[model samples]
Target: MSQSKSLLANIGVQVVIAMIIGTAVGAFMGHSAAMFAPLGAIFINLIKMLVIPLVAVALISGAAGLGNSTNAGKVGFSTLAYFALTSALAVALALIMGEIFKPGVGIDVSSVEGMFSGEYASKGELPSFWATVTGMIPTNVFASLTNANILQILVFCLFFGLALSKQPKKNREPILQGVNTIVDAMVWMINCVMKIAPIGVFGLMAEAVGTFGFSALMVVFKLFLVFIAAILVFGFVIYPLLVQLFTKTSAKSFLVAMKKPQAVALSTASSMATLPVTMNTVENELGVRNATASFVLPLGATINMSGNAIYYGLVAVFFAQLFNIDLSMGAYVAIILTSTLGAVGQAGVPGPSFLVVAVLLAAGIPIEGLPLLFALDRIFDMIRTALNITGDAACAVIIDNIAIEASDLTESEVKQS
Candidate 1:
């Protein structure tokens, strides 16, 4: 309880300080005041650099262990289902909040002239849904590794791992055991790498607060509030309810287990950085089975971006409103669809939300509106990371209920404790 309170208080203080600093710079010094942006950028880059290798090695090791075709298929389906449900819910929440708040109604588009000049050429309509599916099968596993396309790499790893497992027991047992040993060592190394994350997070936060200042924050104040609210409600309330409804776990115990990791994720603002803590918490504290945590937490860290999905949808509409673009109902639907996918595609990067904002602008809305929001990105990113991890835990609990042999405590004990 003390730890939980401390974590919450720490996150609150950091957010408040960041907001005050951001508002002051944006309103006072203006956009040219980019003195601190590099600090945050460097911090974000370091975390991202670790993500590809972490995902590749971890997924390969985990999948390789689950050699049975049926079990592998079940894991794959469950993972995809969780991702789809969370992403869709995020989009829906954004749409609902956007309508209720109408955050962009009175904003002046011209005041921020020359804000964003469409500098980065659009990546074009994210290859259709089919493209995402087809592209998963890498032409060459080595090529996928070189390209660092996580989805393709995951595909290659899954098949490769299963093939090794399918080999005759006499031939495969020793190899599988040896691979597990290597995996254990690599995971330990990854955990060691994460010890420095707090420094990276502090630098990123300091730099972001330094550059953006507070003035730009006021520009999209309403939208920012709505986005944060949506993330909290969905990640904390809606997800817990679902977990309790489906799993024999109480939300309180699960949430208690998540407290430390949540703090790490919030401070670092990188789900990947928090994965080790998340995995440990779920397996040890929450008593989720190793198979469930290994499969769910890692994948959730990479692909199941509930908070980003919400942010993307809300920001797209908010940008449209700020620019006086006036999105039709159809456009809103398209935003829901594209933003969900965009969030996943950009997950491998450090600042994918900002990058995807460019994608949204090219799709039709005003890119200039992004500058105002970008100022608040770091602050929002922290909250979004917290929410992301929460979603990951919730998914783990649900899957554990479905797959784990037995849990340490009953749902009632989970609540009472």
Candidate 2:
């Protein structure tokens, strides 16, 4: 009895309970559950408060501490290659699933009046691809931070950290220490916020269920199932195979080790929230080197978004189908490219799925379908976040293995010399 009671005290367990309670309350109370909206907002706000600082500090510190020029370049190039390849694969899988399932084929939008709230209807056209890429370079660093432009912040940090890496060790130590201190403080802050996560999740879920109700969910149910199926395939089948091929880690062990972090990710619906656990598990449990884990996972959290890539591709196709928009071959190519890049820059939080708006605009699909997507965002957020962090850990393992092989080769060469 005592053991069972203690187990129930765990935050992950509590969060699951909270989700159930929130869903029940929303179902029964309906729109009145929107009263809990503020609570959810406060929780999301707390997590958001930590995002910019945490991402900036983690990236700068990781890059600066990444060792010699050759190693840093190697790791950087390798990580980017892995991210791009996986993202492309993810988008391809989504497109395949979307075509096969045809989630929106039979839906009649004519009778579905006012299903969307028009919250995300675009006021202006989306920027061109070149324009979007150029916009990643921030004109005003402080303004970018204030606006929480993730790609802009990432671009600035990459340059800043590269510069810092070129400085003498004695000159860089103080700055690196300061940045590490900030990272520690941010992680500590996240831990503090996590104490209230159950309540926050409860409120968020309640608000979503209450305001949108089951009807909104039903409208997108087919797309939701298709999305979930894609995630399961990626997480269970694809990730495990990659891990085994790259690192010799068994799928069962990796999955078991990830259970805690995955649960937290599912509950909080934030990859950033799961970072600390991912780092710990990858290093201590999974045997990934600290250096590799530190550099790869933080960057992965910001940019390596397989789950987002899949979601974006499917959502774009779904909207296109619903509106009977016949996409040109050029549009399909654009969706693949834009969705992959968009996932690379997406924030690792609940609502960053909104980035799909940019993809929809680029594909010439109307943004009027956004509200329907938004209504079911939370449900999908949970699953995708779990996949995002899982991919991060897998990347860490693969990189760590490569680093070790390189070290061994260097050692053998030195001995032979």
State which candidate has the highest TM-score: 2
lDDT of 1 at 283: 78
Tens digit of per-residue lDDT, candidate 2, span 1-417: 999999888777787788889989999999999999888788778878887787788778777766543467778888889989998899889988998999888988976657655567553245667887898899999999999887888888878887898889899989888988887788788878878888997997788778878886688889999999999999888988898888878888988788777876876688876787687688889998655776788788878888888998999889889989888888888888888877765677666366787778778888876777776677788888999999999888888788777778878888999
Residue 390's lDDT within candidate 1 is 88
Model 2 TM-score, all chains together: 0.86
Candidate 1 stretches greater than 4 Å from native: 1-53, 69-71, 323-327, 352-364, 405-417
lDDT of 1 at 246: 82
User: Worst 10-residue stretch by lDDT in candidate 1?
Assistant: 403-412
Off by over 4 Å in 2: 113-126, 323-331, 352-370
Clashing pairs in 2: none
> What are the clash counts of all predictions, listed in order?
8, 0
Angstrom error at residue 314, model 1: 0.8
lDDT agreement with native, every candidate: 0.69, 0.81
